[model samples]
Structure formats: C-alpha cells, structure tokens
Target: MRVPHDDGPPPPPRPPKGRKRPGERAAEAGASDMSQEPGRAALSPTVAGGEAGESLSLRPQSLAEYVGQAALKRKLEVFVRAARGRDEPLDHTLLHGPPGLGKTTMAHILAHELGVRLHLTSGPAIEHKGVLAGHLTALGPRDVLFIDEIHRLAPTVEESLYSAMEDGRIDLPVGEGTRARTIGFELAPFTLIGATTRTALLSGPLRDRFQIIEAIEFYGDDELAAIVCRTASILGVPVSGAAALEIGRRSRGTPRIANRLIRRVRDFAQVRGARSIELADATAALLELGIDSEGLDMLDRRLLTMIVENFRGGPVGVEALGASLGEPRDTLESVVEPFLLQRGFLLRTSRGRVATMKAARHLGLELPPGWQGALDL
Candidate 1:
C-alpha cells in the first residue's frame, strides 16, 4: 500500500474529447478498490452478527474489559507498550486456540489502543493474488489487518503474504509473453494479526513470519462466573452470584458459551416475571437447551452412547462417527471433539475414536457384554 503524500499537487483537469490522457487510462485500469463482502464485514470482533447469535454489545472493547488469559494479556501489554513507545506499528502477531476464547477481542483491543483503523478479513475471504494485492495496497502506515481463520488461507494466497510481512513489498507479475515481468511494489509498514483455531494446519514458513505467537487458554470456572456477572450487568439481565456460578460451571469454559446461555436464561427469567436468574432457572434453561450439568449436550451423549453400544467401545474412525451422527467431519473435529477430548470422555487412537470407561459412567450406562477386553475400557 502506498502512503498518501501531503506534498503532492492536485491532478490536472481532464483532457478535451477524443484526446486520450496519460494518467486517465491508467487510473481506469487500476483505480477500483476492494469490496466489503458479507464475510469480510462479519469478521469484526464485535459480537454483532457473530456466530451463535452473540451480541456485539456483550463483547469487551478494550484490554481491561476483556476477561481471563492473564499471562497472554501481560505479554501483549508489554509488547504493545514497547511498540507504541517507538511510534511504530506492532510486529506480525499470531493468536491460536480454541474458538470463543477472546482472540478476536484482543486483536480489536490492540488496534483501538494504537489508535489505528482496523481492517477485518478472514482467510476464506481473500482469494488469488490480485485480491490480496488490493488489500495490502490499501493499507496505510501502521494500519492493522486482521485475518480470522487464517489456517484456511489458500497456499498461493498465503505465499503472497510472505513478502508483504518480511520486506513490506509484493512482487506482482504484469503483462504477458515477452512483456511479462515481476513488478515489486513497496507497501506501507503495517501489522498483520492472524487468528486460528487450529495452529497445526498452518505451514511452518507462515508460522515463523509472526514475531509473537500467543496461545489463548480456556477460562476457569471462577473467571467464567465473573464473566457471567459482567455480561448480565451490561445486558441489564439481573443474575445472582449462585445462579451465575451454576451457569459458569456448565459453560464448557468458554465465555461465548456462557454469554449465550445467559441470553437464554434471561429470556426464561423474563417470561416467568422473575427479578433475577436463580439456580433453578439456570438449570432448567440449560436442560431445555440440551446442555447438562457436566456441559455435555445431547450430541455429546449420543456420541458416547453410539461408541459404547454399536462400536463396542472399540476404536472407530471419525468419518464413520460423523456419518452416524449425520454431521460434517470438520464440524465434529473443530467443535465437539475438542471438549470431549479435553474432558477425557473420548480418546483418539491410531485407529479412531475410542470411548473411555469414564464416559460410560458419566452417562450412567453399563459397559456392553464382554466389554472388559476392549482397549481402554
């Protein structure tokens, strides 16, 4: 991206009819700017139009407003302060972790603190070299370009970012045949903020370009309780500490899920004409939504039951599991599997997914006949 210059004079008037102008023809060919498509516009950290019906009003807009991730916050604070002290853009940063843990919120807070306009896009939004070149060329000095789900970026598009990150330039091939040549254009010094749910899918070369790679951790129950109270206060939905604690315990250690549950429970409370959410209300609301005391929803229980009964708790491939559940493999891997694996209810073996004995006991189901010989049963 070219930085606008203050010393530049205004362009001359358009030429007379039938007399072609030198810059007019070039401007016609290259003046079109990038479009703000729906996907790109929805990438903002604000919860408005976010996945799972989360409200942007509930999202924390600053570092102080953000909850949990103390260690990562401290590291980022020092890093941001140092960069601001030098009056320079922050270096490329990569945030990796499970979804709904405040990675997007942190990126927004960083740009806000630096007093720069943030450009939001995702890996799937940018396609081909021309589209990427347009975005990079539009950046101003010290601007922030946030790319969510960066692991999904096409390999060719990811490679195009290499030069932009390392050298502040992009080499574009112009013309064809004998006239074809690579043109290197300098970009304004800018920051690239990448967020990903799965870091393993990112290439080593792309991962190494980032100066700071931070992993966001799941929030503890107490932290989630505080988040619940904070969100309730913001949304004007009264909630008692006891009720908040109960909701937090079943939130799967995710703020997004906690906030979502709060909305549902609040609706129940309002319908009942109660002043505030109580323990019973929280339980009833979550149960109605299929979330249990252990935070295992119906799908989770179904997964466990299927493995125990049909597969005999033996190893089974994810494809077969998804086929049985009628869900896409990616959905199960990214959303359901993580929490199940974290809680040790499910194990991934070389062969496939194996149901653990703990899972059976949690569901109050007896082991199948002759199940004792099953691996890890």
Candidate 2:
C-alpha cells in the first residue's frame, strides 16, 4: 500500500505570478516544515544498526505480522478500520504492561494501517519545552508520534505536552529575556501514541490523558510456536515444526525472546554439522545456551535461587534483591520479573517480593521466615 504523502488536499491558492511556482514553493514549504520533526525525515535514524540496511526495526508491521495477542489484534483491527474510515486518529493510545510483546510494532502497524507517517522517538529525546514543541509542530494532521518508555517523560517536558495533547496547541517563547512572550501555535489533530512497561510511574493526569490503555500480554504456546516458525522462515533458517514449537514453548511467552532463541539455535546448528534444526539438536542447543525447557534462562534460575535461598522465599524488597544478585532493577523488573510473576513463581506483596509456593517447590526448597505467615493469610 502506498504511504499517504498528502496529509490533506493541496494548498488552495498558487503563489503569485511573479513568485516561484506553487510546486516549488510547496516543496520548499514541506522541507521547511519537516526540518522541525525529529525522526520524521524520509529515512529513520539507525536503530540497532538498521542504518547498515539490516532489519533492526525487528518489530512486525501488521496484525498478521504481529504474533500472539489475538484479542488485542481483534480490537485493534476494529479501531484501525473505524478510525481510518472516519479520517480521524484512532486515539491517544497508551500501550502499557511489560516490554518485548510487540507494543512498538503495534503502534507502527496502527500508523501504517491509518496510512499516516510514523515519527518515532523516545521520551528522553525531548529534553526541553522547545524541543517538544518543535516535534509536535512538524507533525502533519492525523500523524503519529510514538513515544516509547513514556513513563520516563521528565516533569517539565511532560508539562509542555498537556496542552499539546488536549488542545492540539503548543506554547512557544517568541523572544528572549524580559521581552519574551509565549505564543500559542495551533497543531494538527494528531495522535500521541505513548508506550510504557511501567504504567504505575505515570501521573494520574497523564494516565487519564490517554484515550485507550492497551496492555500487551504474554504469548501462549501456539502463538509462540508460530512466531518462532515464522521468524525462522523470515531469517532463512531451516527449522522443523517440532523444533519451532519447542523453541516457542521455551520462549517464556515472548516473541522477541523466541526470535532471539531461533537465531541462537540457528547459529548452534550451523556449527554442529547440522543443516536443519530438529527436536534433539534444538534441545541440545538450548541446553548449551543455558535456557531450559521451561524457558527459564540461567540468570532467571539464579534470580529464583537468590529469592529462595538468600532472601528466604519471603517478602524481599526488589532493591535489596537486586543489590544481592547484581541485577539492574529495571532489567530485573521489566524482563525477568514479568515472566516469573506471570508463571505464578513469584508474588508481589504490599511489603516486597515473595516467592510463591510453586517457586519454592519447583526448586525443592523450603519456605523461609516471613512467607509462612502470609501463606496462612
């Protein structure tokens, strides 16, 4: 499908006869307007060496391209089709919940389905009010501004966005020093697509500003298997169906992890005098990588061990646990913690992190001090 280059109908009147032709003026005008948009040029900035022509954007493009989250796909399709028909943005969509579940890719798909340009950037990239204003100023009507990790938007920068999202207006300083006055610039009716793994950190007002809150849930066995198989095919790896399902079962419900595992397994198979991935070879390869059949990596098991042994299988604070295990809090929280918690291996208490009975029993360990009381409750 062709991208919608025309945001709307052409400017009504041509330039005067003495002036440059309307087409040249239009081109110049577009160039001038586009200069203010970050990540909005004809080319996208290098993401994980995508500048080298590698498929670093990694995320899929459509619901069919997106694996898993079937319910989300159904809802998104309705919203996409309806929004497209009305010629209005879908909404100020906020994608919450854990990472690596195609939140960013879904945003791109939403933009693509709407036939609008997708301007990508992160929350931290816009440091000041002016920078945020400039970015919004450059957006065409009904364009998409994807702000990844939206919970990290600084207070001042977030403040600058209130009016932008609410009224499609941005306040800019017209002059310097005492002579300066704030000027309100009208913006196109655009969509603010915010994504975050940590929705709790967002202010209440900020959360309310979003028109929709869609949480990306973990993938199921079938979804993960299909994702692995499809991803392997796309990367030109010869993968057996069983091997694909095996990899997916071990992917811990994450498509990104499934893709990563496929690559690792492919590498292993290539070096081990094998041209194709079979169940046995895949199992052995995964064993070497320290990813078990349960989809738990060695670090994941180590984290469980830390919780079971060092933290006493009870209420252990994340900071204290991270310090003991040398794990970054955010990484532990976003990647490892989500899977563990989802698998019913860990419990989040009002006090702190506690290993579930399943976790203790899985490790063949006894429950520790504090958990005994909570278990009774």
The most accurate candidate by TM-score is 1
Task: Give the clashing pairs for model 1.
Answer: 47-56, 48-56
- C-alpha-based local distance difference test score of model 2: 0.81
Count clashing residue pairs per candidate. Answer: 2, 0
Tell me the lDDT of candidate 1.
0.85
Lowest-scoring 10 consecutive residues by lDDT in candidate 1? 37-46
Indicate the residue-level lDDT of 83 in model 1. 91
List, residue by residue over 1-377, the lDDT tens digit for candidate 1: 98888887978887898977877677545533312322221112224353344576777877788888888888888988999999999999999999988888888999988888789899999988888898899999999999999999999999989999999999899999999999998999999999999899999999999999999988888999999999888766678899899899888888989988888888777666566788888888888898988899898899888888888886889999999989899888988888888877898878888888888888887776666324454
Q: How do the residues 165-267 of candidate 2 rate in per-residue lDDT, one tens digit apiece? A: 9988988788899999999999999999999988889888888999888898888988988888776666656788899899998888888788788877877
Candidate 1: where are CA atoms >4 Å away? 1-54, 369-377
Question: What are the Cα lDDT values of the candidates?
Answer: 0.85, 0.81
User: lDDT score, residue 52, model 2?
Assistant: 38
